[model samples]
Target: MRRIPVRSLAVLATVGTLVLTGCGTETGDPADSTPAVAGADRTIRAHEVMQLTKVHEETGMTLLEGPTFDGTGKLLVVDVTAPAGKPKVIRVDVRKRTSQAVHTDARGAYTSAQFSPYDGRLYLTDYAHGEVVSLAPDGSDPRTFFSGDVDGARMNPDDIAFDEEGNLYVSDSRGLSTGDAHGRVVRIERDGKESTVLAEGLASTNGVSFDADYEGLWISELTQNRISYLRLDGKGGVASKHTAVRVDGGIAQTDSIAVDAAGNIYQALHGRAAMVVYDRHGERLATIEVPARAKGLESATNVAITPGGTRAYMTVSGPAGGFLYTFDALAKGVRQSNGG
Candidate 1:
């Protein structure tokens, strides 16, 4: 595997911070007025309207991913510590702006967590173990819900989402490099059986989300810097697939995605230090930069919207540490079928 030089990583991290802070140029608030994107209708300067604050900090919890919320409005996040250290799942009280570790298991690298509406339990992707696990909402009673290979290939689950019928859709991002499109989307039926829905043309599928109307599924390609949407057949299969949006210029590496009731897409643009908002037609709406306090962070990895869609929470990871940041969202989020 190729390694990123330490010096280059530092430079990238610094650039990311500067981009979010709007430090170098006097371009006069790109977020304030409408962005010059061809079809953009409105631009929301989120940093101005939404307050960014650090809610919690921990010394060893440095690789945080996934920020999901439950029906009651409690935010759940996962720390991706592995091998040498056990990963932890934490629950946060957004109202109180406080957090508590709910579960700490040494089994495998847990990267993402999703609440199952049908069972009212939290489902997590165990990347190292190549399977999915379930736990009580508070992170108790960890059990192997789905494991082993899917379609004869080792499962490297990265992120997860569910359809209206309670079936699970998982993004199996097999490797980190972009030379090969090894990523695949797997569907786990309500009965726990697994099948491959999409097995090609994806490089590092990082995030998966269903449209509010349950008509389309969005998958983020980390290394490819693109978002693909699949029209569902309403029978647990893809009717068609196509690219919804792509990040050009210097910005690449799209991460987890969140959608609102109005079908607007909120995608974390890792390395760019901003969250790019898109309308239902896949047109760029706005870019909400990360605050300057994330000075040494290389990227914002994941984003979660509140039930009411009034707020958004994102996780940033880099040399400085893992931090959770939030801001006001443009519209109310479509309440997840399964709590969050």
Candidate 2:
């Protein structure tokens, strides 16, 4: 097979250097002016949960993103750049710090893995194929559960979230390369038949998750370097939205995020080895640095906090390869933390 260039998020590298002058007019409730990680809890030296073997060809870099836990207490992650014939999904034995291949397909560059609360099947975003597919519990029966044009155009589906009633919300991460660039959010009903545009005109929508109370959704915009809260109406469309918190990301870009039971957001950062914590109202709490000092561990793209929110498992990768690091959670983990 011919080589297909990887790095579905290659835009991150070019746009990461863009200075975060501001996050629009929503700076009234600003993050603290203190150092990003000042006086923050430096997690204990992390135990290497596992390492990925597959490496992409073009950049010679490997990445592990979309870390979420299965209902049976195992952590599931995606190999964002895994090429054809290689495992695209992995299951981690956090207790033993070992990993096993769960699924592989030649048609997709899987960016996110989320389980539907109503169906119990693992749903993943195929970044390359522009489709949201589902898998059986044992990694069988891969099928295109949702696909086709979103908002009159194709989408580069990035992160995913499932609501209490089994609705799927997706972030389309393409079209952010120019001044007119915008990201989109699409919602699919529980039956996977009807899809509606939830929100649009975003700046590189990356991480997406529901709030603790299910009142709204939290979206991480990479180019703008901020997180936005999409307040949902009774019909699940976006009611009102506001920038929750502006990330003081000097040279880094924001990625996926998880919301705890306390309504705090744990946002992952690309090009930096840290996760920033913020309250529901956009108050900056702390920035937790990556627990390891390895050369390539400086970038953590996604985090999965256990059900209790007592622990967090982050997916880290650079030239040194893909690694998983664990840290303590600032708030109790809730259903929103995992698989979303």
Compose the digit string of candidate 2's lDDT tens values, residues 12-78.
Answer: 3222121111000111111122333323433333345556553466335567888888878889888
Model 1 spans with C-alpha error above 4 angstroms: 1-61, 82-87, 249-251, 336-340
Q: What does candidate 1's lDDT look like per residue over 1-340, in tens digits?
A: 1233211111111211210110111122322433324355344432321112221232222456778887788878876652223336877786665777778754556778888767878988877667788898877798888888776777778788887666888888765433467888888876676566554657878778888888878888877778899898876678899998886626456777778777778777666556777877878876766555436656666777777656667666655555666655666766432122
Q: Predict model 1's lDDT versus the native.
A: 0.64
At residue 123, candidate 1 shows an lDDT of: 87
All models, RMSD in angstroms? 7.1, 7.9
- Cα lDDT, model 1, residue 119: 86
